[model samples]
Target: MSTLENDSLRSALASTPRPPRASAASAALTFGWRGMLKVRHVPEQLLDVTITPVMFLLMFTYLFGGAIEGSTGEYLDYVLPGILVMSVLFTTVYSGVALNTDLTKGVIDRFRSLPIAKPAPLLGALLGDTVRYLVAGIVIIVFGVILGYRPDAGVPGALAALAVTIVFAFGLSWVFTTLGLLLRSPSAVMNAGFMAIFPLTFLSNVFVDPSTLPAALEAFVEVNPISILATVSRGLMEGNAEAGDLAIVLATAVALTAIFAPLTVRLYRR
Candidate 1:
């Protein structure tokens, strides 16, 4: 190397101040913004997240509303809450798929190489996914409004219901995030996630009344955590949420986060 060039390089290094380390929150928010950017570039990813709920809402309300709840209007009111739950929950599956994709593509390894909180990537990814849940829920509620389904509880009630649903989705996302870390492929993560969600949604009071089921099945449906969540959602939007149900829903969210979040961190570290 030329002496003049080497000295100039040394002077530049000596004059430039080293940037301070990023705070944990700052690092996490940066990754969360990165996650949001991915959605911006790949806006097509929202097709499934949106289309399913619209289809379910329309099909169920028109096809079976009269037979099930006596009319489409009444059934719209009855089924919208359940549809919101199903729609938002379906979006959670992608959290794992995205995480798995990052891992497979070595994006996560690049995050690991950065000097940041170890859990920041996972937390930020999950945080960004809250947008998907928001999108799904809003689509259902707005469509339901267009279809003449009104939340008797009005705006505050509807907002409260949406808030609870988002919180629930947020808590449940850890399960998929953990799967993302453990599974070898994004497809596998998705398959396994929907396998669990489908049964929970179908078996719950999300669609039909538990009364229509066989006694044993009805008992199971009544006790199903998904059923409880749907009931709470229904009640909140409908303005009749039982205190006990709300407590149970919050407690369940806490339990899921408590169990799966640490497990995700453990697996991430490994």
Candidate 2:
């Protein structure tokens, strides 16, 4: 309260400079690193992508192989790519679940109070999820190879399929991210996510030939985005990808992101 003390405080304050603002990229990366750390601490959640996919691969291949394709080996070759697409899409459900968890735990409010880039946390969390997708793909492919599934297009083809799956998953995540923002409960978001996914994956040509189905069902499965993804993935790994199929998957992913990303941000702000 003294004049001398006030003068000294003013001098010190004048001498100190404000810290520079963080760049959007840097802020996003910092949050991305945080997201990675969350994965490190909660590694068990990975079982959804790893063990579950492997189980599906095994059950579907061995149980239905003889009846569907006359042999396990033949069925494995035809089904592995479709299984990969299903697995990757299943993992995307967690994007919304994680977002909902953070919102409910008050983390989003805390982040909102910070001076960092607005989209940093959202983008960073999604960026970290890219690792999950990559790991799941690698595990499934390796397991497939061990089980006598050989990609005709070989390693490069497998890698191309992996890349496409990741790109699509990245875009598809925004749809869940928006759900996370709008939903009140993480479990609700998770349930809703699966409800949306089940028909897409199961009703697609993931296990059976669409040609064997009724004309109406065959037409529906053929045009489904999940079916298109399976077609593209099977083609890529089989060394027979059509340009139009690949283009459709890419366009679908881009469209999903374009529509949902802004909606998620708007919901967050409100």
Candidate 3:
């Protein structure tokens, strides 16, 4: 084409108006779907939500159930809720690992060039990771049922218990998301997250009764966030939901999100 025609085409393109950046909610969901697609491409990413939970459920129930609660059946009743909490907590580490991978690999650089909300990637990762927790919840419930475990609170209660756990896990992901941005490697993110969460899950009332612990340990368990979560889940699923325990769990989630969400945003912007 002649220079005149090329100049005319360039002028027309420059005059065209582009749409505004998408709303944070819409961009978040879109990127969230993208995150889910990543899971499809890497099926082994699901081992934490699937294989790990099943193994924990089986090992904990059969091996130590009788010793801890005097019979496998009775222990299964008491253990399912706590195991569900533990499963989701353990799986949350993957959020940090995935986020760190994206950052280290320069995926975030491509995102920066796009006209989307800055927070979309982080929110999307957290939203997508909810599916992982949901899968773990289902695995635990199905295995518990097959093993003769029954929730006294029935379906609605069990669902409420799952919802509570998912919400808490969602908030907790921000803590790791911040680590993913600040840390140099995905492995470092995983190690740091595990170091923070392992003691919270194990030292709390997840595997055993708080009363059975020593005085100092029991003191920590009583106020431990995991203990609050386990108590809320057990109470809700067992038809004894206490207003106080549920309140504590909800408060803990809110506090974690409030503390870490801004930190993650700040670090990611840097």
Off by over 4 Å in 3: 1-17
Model number with the top TM-score: 1
TM-score of predicted model 2?
0.94
Model 2, 1-270: lDDT tens digits are 999999999988885676888988998888889878887898887898799989999999999999999999999998999889889889999999999999999999999998987888899889888888988898889999999888989999999999999999999999999999888999999999999999888899988889999999999999999898988899999999999999999999999999999998888887
What would you estimate as the lDDT of candidate 3? 0.91
lDDT of 1: 0.90
State every prediction's TM-score relative to the real structure: 0.96, 0.94, 0.95
Q: Candidate 1, clashing residue pairs?
A: none
lDDT of each residue in 71-144, candidate 3, tens digit only: 99998988899999999988888888998999999998898777888888889888899988999999998888
Clashes of each: 0, 0, 0
Shift of residue 92 alpha carbon in model 3, Å: 1.3
lDDT (Cα atoms) of all candidates against the true structure: 0.90, 0.92, 0.91
